[model samples]
Target: MDKPTGSTVSPQEALIYAMVTLSAVDRQMTDRELRKIGDVVNTLPIFGGFDTDRLVAVAEACATITREEDGLHAVLATIATSLPKKLHETAYALAVEVAAADLHVEQEELRFLELLRDVLDVDSLTAAAIERGARARYRTL
Candidate 1:
């Protein structure tokens, strides 16, 4: 986290960073989580104009920040600043999706999601809906 060198990032990149941070919060980023991030970038209309080539760099940046003291806060602040109000819930949704990617939500991931909800200013009701939607999407028979 060494105070991210840059203060701003595009909304799409901000979303990717959020997902990357959530995936690594448990100190391990699984292939499932990484795949989920790639799926998101490829399918989400929000990312229609985003350059997929930057995914690796964005994830690396997130990983670097997560190692610094209060890096989580720094990363969340960057996410909040980079995304427009309309995409706040989208960001939270993306985090929740990544958290559930492995089908087992770790305590750290849950805490990160809570922090993300608060940082993104997503109301409890909206947060609940987003969380539920992600759960339904990732559900298996």
Candidate 2:
């Protein structure tokens, strides 16, 4: 799952990596979470030009990076560098969606999301709105 030397990913791929990293942070990636990631990729206009075939590789690269010491920070740095400021909230929203996909946000996921929010520089109000929207979307009667 090692990122190849000097390899870089597109902004869309970086967003996908963020989602995949959150899904796997709890050491379990549920079917619902996986499906949610796929749905986002398939539906988001930001990802419209991305090649689906690269998903596995992007995910693996994220996993590899997260396994290193301070890897989470490294991944966040990569994400920040790849995405424009305007899309920071979008990235945080995607992470929230993936975290809520399994109908439960584990402690690890919560912490990860908090760190992501901080790293992405998403303001509290916006983060709250994004999180609230995801919760509402996944609520069960």
Candidate 3:
């Protein structure tokens, strides 16, 4: 939802939206993908202590974001630009986790993520670390 204030959405909310949108990209949402999203939610400190209701709200927000053609990058861009420099890695990590949720990093997803990483100004090393962690989590290790 775009508010008049134009204040950025919370990073956790943006991340949840990103994951849900990624899962819906193939026009299907599998249990595997849902579980992966849940795992990402649970593991990320930004989403710590999020309740079911909050998760659902975030999912709805994601649906709204997805409906927009700009997609996850727009949400990521908002958060990246609004938050402080110190939080960039946390945002980048969330982007990577969401991009990997479907167990297959589609080209569109990779492109969006790379755009976000660059916009967030995440360094190459941290982006690599995020990708490595995602690969490990998806059992591609």
Candidate 4:
């Protein structure tokens, strides 16, 4: 991933990139994680219809977001208010994938997920369920 050069980018794109890159922060961007990211990126209606071009743009934007911001929470907050509830499951699922990618979820990763859930306004129960799913995935791996 490289820094994006676009003069302007959408908040949604930034959030997606933030989430994806953070998932890989533990130094393992697993096939499962990548697939999950791709599914979330393409299947979600956030971009109306995410394409190669959009994916590339979002990837670039995500790189920039990581470099420019301290961490994921700031990026999440930027678009959290407008994010659709339907996608919380996708977001949670993605977070789980990220956490499980390295076979271990760091406290920082957990914190980031917690912040993400908060920012997205996802209920605690849903957040807990997602965390459990991530933990389950790790255990099976």
- lDDT of each candidate versus the true structure: 0.87, 0.85, 0.67, 0.60
RMSD to native, candidate 3 = 4.3
Off by over 4 Å in 4: 1-15, 24-36, 39-48, 69-73
lDDT of 1 by residue, 1-141 (tens): 222333778888899988999998898899999999999999989999888898898889888887889898888888988888899999998999999889999999999988888877889999889888888988999
Order of quality (lDDT): 1, 2, 3, 4
Candidate 2, 60-131: lDDT as tens digits: 989898899978777877887778788889999999999988899999999988887887778899999998
Q: What is the C-alpha lDDT profile of model 3 across 80-99, one tens digit per residue?
A: 54566787777667657766
lDDT of 4 at 123: 81
- Candidate 1: count of backbone clashes, pairs at least 3 residues apart or interchain: 2
| Model 4 CA lDDT for position 127 | 72
* TM-scores for every predicted model: 0.92, 0.91, 0.72, 0.65
Regions of model 3 farther than 4 Å from truth: 1-6, 25-28, 69-73
